[model samples]
Target chain A: MTTPAGTWNWLTDPAHWAGEDGIAHRLLEHVVLTAVCLAVACLIALPVALVLGHLGRGGALAVNISNVGRAVPTFAVLVLLLLTPVGRWGEGPTVVALVLFALPPLLTNAYVGVREVDRDTVRAARGTGMSGRQVLLQVELPLALPMILTGVRTAAVQLVATATIAALAGGGGLGRIITAGFNLASTPQVVAGAVLVAALALLVEGVFAAAERLGPPWTRGGAR
Target chain B: MPPDDCLARNEWICGAYLSTRRRILLDATLQHVRITVLAVLIGLLLAVPLALLARRLRPAAGPVLAGTTILYTIPSLAMFSLLLPLYGLSESLVVAGLALYSLTLLVRNILTGLRGVPEETRQAALGLGYGPLRLLLTVELPLALPAAMAGLRVATVSAVSLVTLGAVVGHGGLGNLIYAGMNTYFKAQVLTASVLCVVIAVAADLILLAVQRLITPWTRTERA
Candidate 1:
């Protein structure tokens, strides 16, 4: 509400929503980048965490190492990548940087979720003639589902927000709108861009939260 | 000047980045540290009281948690754009935004730590005629230190990286180096700043870990 008139005007303008530089195009770019990066991050992080959690070995070390990604600025990593050969491929560096940033939450959540499962439950599953693989797939994985989803939710929301940095590296995303607004000194346009990003992040959070509620009753909190 | 030789000549390449602007680097690091520490400290202080209030008032917990969670989900770039109109390129906007971001984590951790204290311990403290204030200070806080400290460690790491993004709002730090480096295609500057950001994060995290260990000695001992 800082510049109520200007911000309102920008939000209502049909031109900002209809063309190549319109909100639709930018929103699609942001969504695609977010989805691609998140999918790749999940692919890389989920299996490692699950296997480690299933094996009950080296999970802590892996989690700790991945936490390093949290400490390193994604923007910094993005810039560094942009200077390397990876930058030559257009959006490659940005995607890699985003994937790296998204890893810690997914890895930590999955590992911790698995580790937190009741030992007796595992033992009981084993007693029921379940093999190690069966115990993991049938018991531990189910129990860990909530935590894993929580991690995914966290990463997804974060990626939606942080993906804005992709624009800084000449990659297409909603961040370009804000930066473009800055270049033109259009505060309302910048504000509008921020609103879109925040709204998208909240939308992602809501979807995951709803998914969590609609999940199997066993995975829900208070089920125990 | 081959890529392989550049990688092998580690010191030589690093030296190129540090050849000039030593003063600028030092100043930027100090600014980065100052901004991060200040934001987190303020967040921690604010979160404790809010958390205590939420614990005491059950009806308030839902709203308080939801509000802070929403605040945390706001994308950094948009948060900046929204804030720019109100705070206008000042340190206050960045600190305020980050402090708000830290609250959800810190408050939840504090609440968890407080709740984790055994009911028997609380009863004993009450039976001893200990006042609420005294019991909280001597009994609850010490027990809660571990959880609170864990929250602090995460917040500090996040704050360090977020401070770099504050450069976008003109609050200069190591992020400014990366920002300028990107604009100029200067690998040396980008590399130096990114590495320093990681180093700061890692060092801060380690120090917090040490502090947590020192403060929670009972955690290391078994209850025979």
Candidate 2:
């Protein structure tokens, strides 16, 4: 933990790269935190958004609430949770915090995607004797797939980045390395951690971008 | 003897604790206000110029804007950790990190606003013998201001929340209070900080709404 001027020496050290406590392990932890948070967020947000989008009456309020959620600081929420009875368990608090952090984009995108579907398509489906549920599943869902995927993409990137804050609350991730590096004034560790996080973000963005491209052509046309 | 001992132990300590909690809330509110203002001002100064450069050079703008998008997605705690050794517990680190976070939103909005300006207006400005600067200031910027301000409003609210991350670096904003409360298991302090952060966010949003109204009188007039 000593503050060495040439801390990059760790880069060539086999021991630092080989153990269970290495870069691979940290990345696994990050991925787990991100995945779990996103899964839970989607579970909560998607259904609510779908229901609201179908109703159309409460969509504005739902979207506004989601917008407010976006404005709230993730770390503040994490810290607040950590100070409570829930904080005694440690890891669960981090998961809850990340879920809350990821919710806005998921909800907003789902709602907007459904809301933005062509009125004619919806009208046509209803005209052809499709029930509301059938229209949602058969027609609107396909049309809104691109936007829904885009929201998931946003949530994925956001959750990955924010999972790092778990380090502040003693939850393990790449953020732990970054925070330790800062505490020890070790530039190489800091650089390595930042680079890993940045690369991960790019990777997620690329994956999602490709998925968005592969979505329905009509939605792509609308996007363009 | 038992009653006297219990009363002596609890009452005085509770009174002192309540007063300290009240003081912490007041300090956090003030600190949060300052951090939001500083971050938004600095972010605007940096983003506007970068956006202008992006528009003028369409080829390079894609990669450059992509880089900022990456920056925006980096976790706040991770970014702060990366900056710690060089900046060393300074306000500059927080301000710079928050500004970097705002780049994606601000640049996107600026580009959108500039692109949205009617083609005819630009042609008319050129026909009037106005140079690039004059045309941009007189015709383009005024037209773009509303959209740009929408981006600014988003950035400002984000910056307000992000400044809390500065708490980990030892800067005493609302985040610091929240983190401290969590670390020490102080529920009152945690609640106070959380409430104050939300209040500041809402208040700042209202102020931005007012500023938007002042700057974009046409929007209000149109509404009327």
lDDT per residue (tens digit) for residues B112-223 in model 2 = 8988999998999999999999999988998999999889888888888888888877774888887887777666666667766777888888898999898888888888
DockQ of 1: 0.79
Please, what are the lDDT tens digits per residue for candidate 1 over residues B85-174? 877778888887888778778998898898898999999999999999999999998988988999899999988988888878777589
CA displacement after TM-score superposition, residue A156 of candidate 2 (Å): 0.4
Residue pairs clashing in model 1 are none
Model 2 in CAPRI terms: which quality? medium
Model 2 residue pairs with clashes: none
TM-score of 1: 0.92
